[model samples]
Target: IVLDRSGSMAFAHDEVAKNGSPAAAPPGWKMGHAVPKDARWLDTVAAVNGFLDIMDDSSHDERVSLSTYSDKSKADVKLTSDYTEIRAAMNTHSRKFKGGATNIGSGILAGGKTLGDKELARSWASRVLIVMSDGIHNTGTEPVPAAQQVANEQIMIFTVTFSDEANIQEMEKVAVSGGGQHFHAKDSQQLAEAFRKIAKSLPTLITF
Candidate 1:
């Protein structure tokens, strides 16, 4: 999974009822009198955790890696079946994921490199790289060319655009070049559902 840790991710999502508060709105107020907006990072984390849970329930053996990009890219996890490790990296306050330019292409390249390294050792596994971004690519390598290069190696790349501010058209082109699909998420619920769909679609491609 490639995640965007750009500064814009610190922006807020639609308001939701706070913990311990009733889910249903009172009478006139939406979400029970305008609670604080959930940060995009928080919602992304929750959606990712939900995705991990669904993947864990699958019968096929699957391994996942994590890559985050801002002004640069770093592979946080490398092809592990231990989902908790991925969860912890997002949940913990150890690494503050804030402030940086959105380098979407760098993230994709990092993910492709990680998958390529593992492919040499595990040729039997079907590799898929899922890249999620909440902002436009302003620095680093060009995403479409990078994605095409990876696709030429027979690795599928899925692109996901989160929030209205995301560049859906550009990401859709990336997905097409990479021989995969693109998903757009307008809100938190849709984000979770998008992950669900991606996870559920993998079993067919997975080889034992």
Candidate 2:
């Protein structure tokens, strides 16, 4: 899964006190970036963990990798069948990287590389890039070209707009360009449901 960890993603419902804005944050925290106090970020992480848990329960023989991006892309979890390891890699976001900008194109490139790893490409029957984002891009290269490049290599990409404020049209275009589907989640519950549905490749966006 490719997740966005940009500044825009770190917004609290009840603002706390971050860089003049009321938002809770770690000690000595600076402005221009998000801290752990973001409700939306918490929701995204919870939904992702839930997704991993569901995958573990299914016990499907699948190798999954994780990529997170904000001004740059980091492949935290290389392709592995161990869901627990993936979860651990995800949890390290407590010490998140500098994310004043959203480099979605970098995320796509990194994920595509992970899937296209020669050793993996030979064994894996399918490759899919699932990118979840809650904000529009502010920095980094335009996302479409990189997305197109990844798509050309046959890595289908599913773009998830994590909130109503998300750029649905851009994500939809990304999905179309990458030969995958687009999904929108208005709340935490819907986000969880979307993840579950994606796991099963179901047609509907809702689970219940």
Candidate 3:
């Protein structure tokens, strides 16, 4: 999974903040409510955690990798069945989500590299890359070309445009280039449902 942790992800779903806008500190003593100030980011984390749970309950033999991008990209975990490791990396990265540019291409490339690593990957397993972004790509390599490069290597890319301002057109093209599907989620519930649907559809790919 390639998740966007860019600066703009710190805003509400309807509020499209600039690329470098300062992130509000996570809710604490200063805020009466326990929920974090960044509603969109909170929803994203919840949806991802929910995705993990659904995947765990499934019968498919799946290995998952995590890559998060801001101004840069980092592959937090290599492809593995150990979902706990992915969660740990995700939580650690969440704390550092202060603010940065969105580099969707970097995130996609990072995820593809991990899945493409023959040494770490199972030869018989299906390869899929899920790229979820909440803002426009403001930096790094062009995403569609990156998707093509990965798809050429047999890695299918699924994209999730997580807000009203997310680049739906560009993401749709990326999904097409990668030979997968594009899903748009305007709210948290839909976001979780999208992940659920993606997870459920994966095991059937080889049969088709």
Candidate 4:
């Protein structure tokens, strides 16, 4: 799972509840973003943990690596089935730098490297890369071309725009280039449902 940890993500997703918002809201708020300045990273992390839950409920059994980017990209967890590791990484990362320009290209490149041939050699194992962001790529390399390269390798890329600040057009390009779909979620409900759909879309193991 590729996550965006830039400072802009600290902005409040205070929009009203919608039709398909995440079934579970964060502890405090009934519906909306639950992030304080010092606790600014909770909004995205809450949705992500929910996404992780959906994955756990699914039939697929595979380790998921997390790649986060702001001004630069970093791999938090190598490949691990332990959901706790991903959560720990998020909790630890929340305390890190929360300000920087969004460098989406860096995130994509890191994800590709982390999940390249060595990490994903099973031909039968369908590969998918999910890129979520709340803003446009304003730093580092261009993400479109990088996404194209990953697509060339047959890795499906699903792009998500979680806020109105995100560049829908560019994210759409990335999804199309990577041979996948683009999703937009202005509020928590839509965000939760987006993850649920992605989980459902993953390649499932068939039994004879």
Candidate 5:
């Protein structure tokens, strides 16, 4: 999965209820509450973890990798078949960083390279790329061209737009160009459900 670590993700959304709180309110609130800044990052992590938890273990042949992007991009973890190692790497590598630009193009390219590096050992029937972002393509090489490059390499590019601030039309075009799905998630619940949808669709692709 490719996560956008851009600064705009700090924007708040509505909160959900738990514990003895009223079904509509979060804590000391009315019918609704916005997500606190302190809680957004953890909510993202939990959403990712929830998706990982539901993935079917039967597909042992497949390998998964992760990448995050902001002002620049880097590979958090390379493609690996070992779930334990991936989980550990995710815990260690997925840090909260506040950067100005969103280098989503570079992020996708990095993910493609990571997957390509493992292509010799693991032949994937379908290569999947999941990108989650909350803002427009303000910096880096234009996203569409980069996305096209990845598409030419036969990688499916799934995208999740987390905020209205993002150019959803362009993101959706990227997904269509790469033969992947596009999701719009404005809050924690929508984000979690989006991840679940991605997990459920994983089986449709045959991993070599």
Candidate 6:
């Protein structure tokens, strides 16, 4: 899976302050006032943890990987089946750094490389890339070409757009180019539901 860790995510409507203290909603903001006191980042972390908790482990031969994109992209882990380690890494670093531009193209390319590695390619029945972002492309190469490259390699790419600033048109293009699906989430609840749907549909390419 791929996550967008840009600065915008810091204000993802659900993220609370970096410190443990409650986040204050803007004055007169009735809607956001009802949001949880914690930072949206923490909420995202919890959502990811929840999704991981219920993931099907019956397929012993399956492998999964994670990558995040920001000013600089990094593959936290290569394709592996070590859910314990993956879960630990997610809990530890999911809310680490919060700055820079969104280098989505590089992230997708890197994810493709990790997925295309000889061992994973030969063993898994399917290879999938789930990209969650809340903003438009501001860094790295254009997202469409990178998405096309992934598609050419026969890797499925799923996208979740979580902010009004997100370029819906571009995201849609990328999804179509990659032969994947595009999803939009306006709030934390919607985002959580979108993730749930993606998790439940993990074993197949078709959306639920």
lDDT of 3 by residue, 1-208 (tens): 9998876677778776654332454424222223245657778888888889988997876788999898899998998889999888866655555557889999999999999788889877778999999989989988999999998888888999998989999999999998889999998899999988888788765331
lDDT (tens digit, per residue) of candidate 2 on 95-117: 55354577888888998899887
What are the Cα lDDT values of the candidates?
0.76, 0.75, 0.82, 0.73, 0.68, 0.69
Q: Which has the greatest TM-score?
A: 3
Question: CA shift at 141, candidate 3, in angstroms?
Answer: 0.3
Candidate 4 clash pair list = 20-189, 21-189, 22-189
Model 1: lowest-lDDT 10 consecutive positions = 28-37
Could you give candidate 4's per-residue lDDT for residues 1-208 as a string of tens digits?
A: 7888776665556532233322333444321243344222466677778878877776767667889998999988776677889998987765553456789988987887766747544566667888888887989979899899887777889888887778999999998888888899877678877877777766641110
Tens-digit lDDT track for model 5 on 1-208?
7877655444344433122332332456421233233343445666777776775355546667878777788787787665566566544433423434678888888877776775433663578888877777778877788889988887888888875566789889888877888998877888899988887877774231
Please give the ranking of all candidate structures by TM-score, highest first, separated by commas.
3, 2, 1, 4, 6, 5
TM-score of every candidate: 0.84, 0.84, 0.89, 0.82, 0.78, 0.80
Tens-digit lDDT string for candidate 6 (92-113): 5543444457888888887888
**Stretches of candidate 3 exceeding 4 Å from the true structure:** 19-35, 206-208
Clashes of each: 0, 5, 0, 3, 0, 7
Question: What's the lDDT for candidate 4?
Answer: 0.73
- CA shift of 157, model 1, Å: 0.9
Task: For candidate 5, give the lDDT.
Answer: 0.68
RMSD of 2: 4.1
Candidate 6 C-alpha error for residue 58, in Å: 4.8
